[model samples]
Target: MLSRVANNLIWMNRYMERGYSVLNLLKVNYSAHQDSPDLFPWTPIINNYCGSDSGFSSENSIECINHMIFNLDNQNSIINLVTRSRENARSVQEHIPRELWLGINSYYLYLTKPELPNKLYQEDPVVFLDRLLNHQLLYYGKIDITQERGSAYYFMDIGKFLERVIQISDLASMKLKEIAKTSDALERSFLWKNFLLSIGAYQLYLKKYKSTFQEDFIIKLIFQEQLFPKSLYYCVNKLSRHINQLIQTNELVNNDLEFLLGKLQSTIQYTTIESINEQGLTNFIASIKNDITNISLSINNVYFSNQS
Candidate 1:
């Protein structure tokens, strides 16, 4: 496969995964705002997801949500992401399945509807977001059912897992930063609940940790629980498997990438809640995020350098 095609495939999946995660964050944050209006501020979310230059430094909830969802100028907005995802897929249409392309194109067209912004602003926000979320689910379903398990599949799968891990880390880190500011047990539990729900892990958290929301255990679940698909350990493990398959089948000679991935996998696998506390949660998360960034750069340098 051409490097450009591979790059497009990876970026296409990354945008799709990122847009879905952001939608979840927006929906959960909206609920959190209603549940604890004083505690849940939109400024931090804006800064974290949208760049600092997004010009929405102030917290106008409706305005922020609208901008994040519809503003093409905001590069990280859902509309922009879906647009980019479709563009990337279009560039490599032959490499992907027909159904997948149509699904992506349909998603892009849905976002283009002028009434969406007004609907989200005027009507029930959850319903509006859920409709888009369901669209994403259908798109992903098409990818899984239609795409063959070939090199293209591996590339896209890697993109999906990589983007997921990055998002999990960012969301967990943001919640942890907020958690650090307050010592109130009740507030901490609320924050943790919001965090879990943001990543669609709340029910599993309740099932596995029947005890009152223990902070350490929640951290453990998100960081290393292999059963949880969105956990850092699980995503990294899947990323390693996909990369390994690519290596074996393609006979790619990229030692730096393999080494970086192996190191990251080992770090996540060996990390414990106790150790995380010892290292300080903020510092520990920073390290993991840094490693993930390095891995991303290594992949670009090795596989996609030929582009441009």
Candidate 2:
């Protein structure tokens, strides 16, 4: 595959996944803020996840939701992400199947419509977010069904799960940071549940843990659960496998990517939650984020463009 084609395919899916991550974060936590406006102040979450809650009319739910979804100036907004995703896909249109291309383009067109912002804040916020969320599902499902299982397929999958690994870790860190500030048990559970729902892991979490929601158990579930698709461990392992496949195909000798991936997986496997507690969750997650950033840079250096 051409490097440009591979890069576009990779980035197209990365932006899509990222957009979904942000929108889903809002989706899972929105109703609670709506129900109890005072008991729960949502500014911390907005500030932590969406950068800052500034420039909006108010930090209320509608305004905050608008900021995350419709503020084109915010580089990470859903519309920007979908736009980037489609543009990248456009760069490699020949490589993409017809149905997948149509699906992505259709979603992008829906988001770019001028009425979206008003519809979100005035008519119904959940419906707008859900429509976007469902679009993500449909686009990915089209990819699974239509795209051939080949190098292009592997590259796009790598992009999705690579972003997944980072997002899963980062969201956990953010929710845990919020959880630490609260004294009430109910609030702790609410934050934890939101974390699971954001990643579409709530039911799987319930089936596995059943009775316990301890910090240790939840950390283990997030970081170490091999069977769960959204776990950090699972994403890392899958990413390593995809990169290995790419290396063989491209005939490239890049040790940095493999070594970092191995070290990350080993740390997650051997380190216990007790040891993580000693380091503290904030510091621990910060280290994970740093490591993942380094790995991403190394991969970009070697494979995508401007090869070292």
Candidate 3:
């Protein structure tokens, strides 16, 4: 329950979650364009997300892969994310299970290899990204069976969902903006499905619902589907539960954290697709982004800010 441990847990998961999401973005764009122009959409997106434009403008897909996979300048790069996540895992090694700690260390070691950039560039970057994502997903799968289901687990869960919710929201926002400007219906349809696919929700969506692709359907699926783990609703619900667990375990008396998450989750739960259509996707997604930021700040204030 120490602030240091909590901070490390949140950050370790944040970096890893963001790393996986970025890899997903790379996979989506590279898979779409690898055969023809070799250029990828991630350079601009990464440059925008990381707020640094030093090497992104001229970098082709392969060069951008080098920067994203191994560059030290980009803090959001996989190597740095793995490095920082592993460092935080090291800090809490004794608290978490050996399997989880070893997993983090092994991932870091894999990224630190000298041949990674060459392999990423030469051997189908999307394949490499997919493999890395599977490895990361495998690593996360070990947590539930191995790690203790106490405050530590709750802390890590909060970290994972918090980062995930934000990433999906941002990507969804980007896709919505792109979709809004498209003149062709076919392109809009593709963009709508692409948005779902980016977050790993496409197949489940296809199997579950038989609706034709529309912006509202995709947005509703991403935001309203409680069954989909990657959806905004699911993430928020999971986050609120973890927060409740933390409250019970620590006997913390913070009410604002509960209130903030409660309001957000309730809005997601009660609002129907009709209401979301009326409110507008851009506005709805933007408000959720703001609420998540506020919740994160509130968490810091309540649990970590005052710890000495």
Candidate 4:
């Protein structure tokens, strides 16, 4: 595939994945707020995931949520990601089909309307986020079904899976920290269940563990389960498979990426929840984030950069 096409595919997936990440975060926090009214702090919620809480510290929940959701300055905001995705789509307009570009462009324009912000923040925030997420998923489904499954598809898959892996890791880390500090059993269970729901894994988790809510079981499912798509191990395994395909096809030959992914897969597959707890789950999560960032950089060097 041409380098420009590959870059466009990679960024297209990245921007859409980012949109989903932010939407998931917003949905989770909103649910938590409903459950624990007094404990819900919107600012920390924004900061914990996207690091955009600093600018809107003094604002009320409505204002803060609006700013984070609609403001262009918040780079990770839904509006921003939509805009970025459209920009990426524009760059590769000739490479992608016209229908796909039109769909993406329509969504981008929908988000930027003058009245949309008020409707999203004041009338119903959850619905707004859900609509945004659904639009993104629709675009992805179209891409998967319509686009040719070639090198471009591989790069797009890499971006989606990698972004998901990193986002899930950060969420796992944040939930672990919250669980460790909280002393209330009720709150703990709510938070734990909320974590699962955040990743859309609660039902799967219940089925796997027979509705058991043990910390160890949750950790194991989130980290080790290969069937769960959001699990660290599953994401890494998917990434490794894509990387291998790239290598076999001669589109990419980055042994360093293979090694890094292999290390991550091995660690997640072999490490125990007990060991993670003993070593500190936060620290372990931090390490995983660093490893993922490093692997991403390696990919950029080997595949995306001109020097490669």
Clashing pairs in model 4, backbone N/Cα/C closer than 3 A = none
How high is the CA lDDT of each candidate model?
0.86, 0.80, 0.79, 0.78
Off by over 4 Å in 3: 35-40, 52-55, 305-308
Best by lDDT: 1
Superposed Cα deviation of residue 273, candidate 4 (Å): 2.2
Residue 233 CA error for candidate 4 (Å)?
A: 1.4
Assess candidate 2 and give its TM-score to the true structure: 0.92
- Collision pairs in model 2: none
lDDT digits (tens) for residues 160-182 of candidate 4: 88888878887787777777778
Model 1 whole-model lDDT (C-alpha atoms): 0.86
TM-score of each: 0.96, 0.92, 0.93, 0.92
State the lDDT of candidate 1 residue by residue for 64-174, as single tens digits.
Answer: 788788987788899999988899999998989999999889888888987777887788888888899998999899988999999899999888998998899898888
Residues 22-100, candidate 2: write the lDDT tens digits. 8888877687677666544567656665566454445478777877787778777788888888888988888889899
- Once model 3 is optimally superposed onto the true structure by TM-score, how far is the C-alpha of residue 264 displaced, in angstroms? 0.2
Lowest-scoring 10 consecutive residues by lDDT in candidate 4? 52-61
Ranking by lDDT: 1, 2, 3, 4
What's the count of clashing pairs in each model shown? 0, 0, 0, 0
Candidate achieving higher TM-score, 3 or 4: 3
- How well does candidate 2 score on lDDT at residue 276? 95
